[model samples]
Target: MRQRLTPVPADLTGTVVTPGDRRYAGLRSTYTTRGTPEAVLLPRTTAEVAAALGYAREQGRPVAVRSGGHGLSGSSTNDGGLVIDLSALNRVEVLDRATRLVRVEAGARWAQVAAALAPYGLAISSGDHGNVGVGGLATGGGVGWLVRSYGLTVDHVRAVKVVLADGTVVRADADREPELFWAVRGAGAGVGIVVAFEIEATEVRNVGVAQIAVAARPDGSTLRRWAEVLRESPRELSTAAMLLPYGSSTVLSITAVVAAESLRRVRPLVAPLREIGDLLDDRVDLVPYPALVPTAHLHPNVGQQPNLTTNGLLAGMDGGDAAAIMRAARGRHRALVQLRSVGGAVNDVPPEETAYPHRHQETLVVASVFPPHGPGALDAAWRGLADRVDGAYVNFESRADARTFGRAYPGPTGERVAAAWRRYDPDGLFRAPGRLPDLTASRG
Candidate 1:
């Protein structure tokens, strides 16, 4: 019976990608540059998605949902399983201006939504770059430029429509399925495939942004200084620091952003960085966030390879930790070290209240570098390089880990979210790496 689905549906009004098709290969390949899927189902509507899931469930076929295909994990593909391409459902709608709310399809990009909301003087709290999908980003503990002030991408989410393992299509929000809603915020991809999202938009206009890069300091003194600065900076301003090395020199990239309210008056705050080092270039200007993305695109590209990253929260690390990282990065691939200044609104909400942890941590440090394919010795080099760091980022973990997923969230949030996942998916159908497992016991 499942063989009938092999042919492209003529009446479905959406594209169906099957094996042996030219487009099938590209559609099935994940952005991680890893594995490919067996078959692809592109559904244009929520009902179509439900139907696809119904078909898969009846056939007892394992299924994986593909959003951005940008996830670092292999969640979007299977060796021989059904794959749902949700990018077909990508849509964004302005619900009401007075209410400051919008409905976005699961496949919509942060750039698309921000562009859609610019005319209304409103925007959702989104991540740094514009290319990332809102669905996966929000579900994986979204930490964005606006997070320090407004909160996470999930914090603004009002509701989500999901297709569960049993082919159940349900809408969950703050007031409806509150338990599932809480879990959906952090565990949506694991619990089910989210089709749409309702989010609260923030009022923002001309904002101040600064992109500064300087010659490598003797130590991370300047980088650490930036971290301290971000901690006390007004909530209106957000900052992130990156250490990049080229040849014998390393550059400290400090990016500072001020919310619209302080757009015109942030020079006093940004001027301190100029004195921190031998300045290379500083571009500080006032512009709408929608306009800032052009500058955001200038940095490293996550698509070049399968990214392996180690990320965690730190209270306060002296210069010694920086030295250890530098020593660990002695080879060809210079590790791009990142330390996010996390605080403000992120701390006001209790960690257990949501699936996202790392709220109380004063700062977050991430070590990111992609896999290199070369001489046989390179594999050992990469493995030995990662040994210098501890643990992995949920967003960047090679794949989901059932045993340690609970540890990703702070407090008892992981266990609480696991219970909600059971109530929703019940079967281990939607499970992915770096996320909780499906509620198989409940389904049994």
Candidate 2:
């Protein structure tokens, strides 16, 4: 028998979904974890979201906040708790065409945002996947296809409308509620539920994309060469490479994105990458920016892609560092390894500028192990490259422990992030259990 749900506030009557409701099945889980939340509140407006928060607080149950529900950590849903589902609030509007400013609701997916901005020839550098929610990625960090040229999605966020833990609605920007605005850009999950963001989009209508595959040397020479090429290349070029098992060896499959409109400019930018290794396959196409993150990738999250994921950032990749990464990818556990270029425009931001302070890192290394294998296997695989990593990206991590907090928010950045989280959410209302470290304790 289903447990009885507490009576919801009158303001949230139609917005509340219980286990008995038909929609509960779809609302109870995320992409990486299954949940059994007692109630899922679907707020359609800022007022409704405030009401939903009040209603959930009265029940004295753990509250999980969700935007697109594609978070790798699966903190958006919980067992027998209350979940604030923001999907219904999705809206993308061009606030100012002259300045390329866009007002995007938190619930809006990257795909929807791309589709909405296509006509204006403006685009925000969001994550590679279109299904990823704007709230989570923008709040945390948005390393996207155009990252080298446009920078992270959070970097473009000019302002944000958030619903605080105490049911207070406030809009934060550099000039207004400045501290809250700083935390919202990178450490938002611990502070509040961000409903919308006013971002300054870039003028980009089309780009040149290339897919290249090459046989990698077991000694990591090929990986080192790939990094060298990227370091010397122009900011317009950004690439993501995956190391896959091929026959008795490994293959480095690379997707290079160039922020250039014509093939002539794109060809020259990506030419050096082909010389890195023995190229097996190569193709380049000049396509619209929206095509890179199309609506075709939209899908519901129902605990579909369960896996263990972790990541680390590297300042530079030497031959030894490259060897360690290759060993991890070909280890006994054999975790799937992916590398993304991250320097260029990302480094243009000063370390003290925002919550995401690791601006000097040149590469992002992510490793994932699907089920049948678990955390132990994932950890074992990551051991080789552990000491070489400079920092970690919060969005790619599955475990939200103290160590991760320290890495994601290092030194002064961590201290400021913790203080901001405590100031905005003194009662620890938005800090999901085990999802974030206790802000009161010294982050090790």
Candidate 3:
């Protein structure tokens, strides 16, 4: 039996692969094993993106956009719909060397951006790994090695070029389309596809890197103390502490970065961390800003595992919360609880200033359970911890329901974002995975 081919959009400048195509399997693969879309549209230019969106609107099919394809929630891929793949638009350019202003295409990876700006001694505070796409992280509020020192990637965004749901191309910034600019910073996926971004970079020299293994305390006194130190530590240092199960006893793997040119400045910033637990292993050195990205840690297995993850932002943790976290970490095998210190310059930005409203958060906690494993227990454990925190970082959230989305963008902030969704995408042609409320209908 012959199957009828789905017609590709006539104006699409890039490739389109359907279900029966040989390349479909490879094109549809992502960081998590998500459902295959009916067609994958790879658009290279902004006009082509508009054409694809117009076509998706005409077909009345759900539209999902893919960048680096490393989204843990698998929102970038879907079944029986259109997946806009932006891999062909990966270009990083230095717009101004003096101000360290850089322009990055949506499809570009943080690593490529890093490598491009390294020669000029410029860097953008991005996700921990280099392979993470600029579009997803920048829009959703980036938390990275330089978070404490420089703030989120979205903080540095000077402007953005977005294709709204109606296939209209618009430039958003503080002075132009200001409301859309605010919405795109944190709740981008809900409104439109960001084709490119102009980011203001920070000048830097060699930065300090520390990878340490410390013995974990079951009662979580160490975890509490670690949090205290990070709260009091200098903004120059940012750290991510991971609690992993290690036969009979748990281990805390600490990765810290200090944005400094000398070992003298780095040593004092890391001294408090050294006092955490029995230091099982320690490695501290200075590396170029780009080298700070831990590429090896980004999706080490690719799309093999069904990645289950939960995220929360804590203003401060008490003894009860620490004990709860330790208990959760011990529940699942190969489960990891990552707590990143996040309140330096990040807190300097007022909650109302940007779409990201978590400026009050002291720490960002991420609980991940990897594959070759069981089921509901992982989610159950993560949910228990989520109850303790104020909110969740959108990038780290795994659940794709309206409830989870509400958690990610909550209260008045959520309402504003929904209003933006209504204003920019009244018809809702751009379909995000979650069951977002019908704000447009409500407006009617």
Q: Identify the runs in model 3 with alpha carbons over 4 angstroms from their true place.
A: 1-6, 20-22, 294-302, 332-334, 372-375, 432-444
Question: CA lDDT of each candidate?
Answer: 0.68, 0.91, 0.81
RMSD per candidate (Å) reads 4.1, 1.5, 2.5
Model 3 global lDDT (CA atoms, 0 to 1): 0.81
Candidate 1, 1-444: lDDT as tens digits: 334444433444455677778777567756665454556788888888887776666645568787766676657766567778777777888898899989999877777777888889888767777766777887776777766788778877888898887777888887877877787776667778889998888898667788888776546576566666676577777777787775677777888777755644777667777667789989888878687543344322223456655565655545755554444343455655676666788778776666775566666666556655332323333354333333223664553655336446434666676666776766666764323454345332
Give lDDT tens digits, candidate 3, residues 271-363.
Answer: 888788888888889998878664444442236657778788888879878887888888745467898989999999989878898898888
Q: Would you estimate the TM-scores of all the predictions? A: 0.86, 0.98, 0.94
Order of quality (lDDT): 2, 3, 1
Model 2 steric clash pairs:
none
Find the candidate with the highest lDDT and give its number: 2
- The order by descending TM-score is 2, 3, 1
Alpha carbon deviation, residue 270, candidate 2 (Å): 1.0
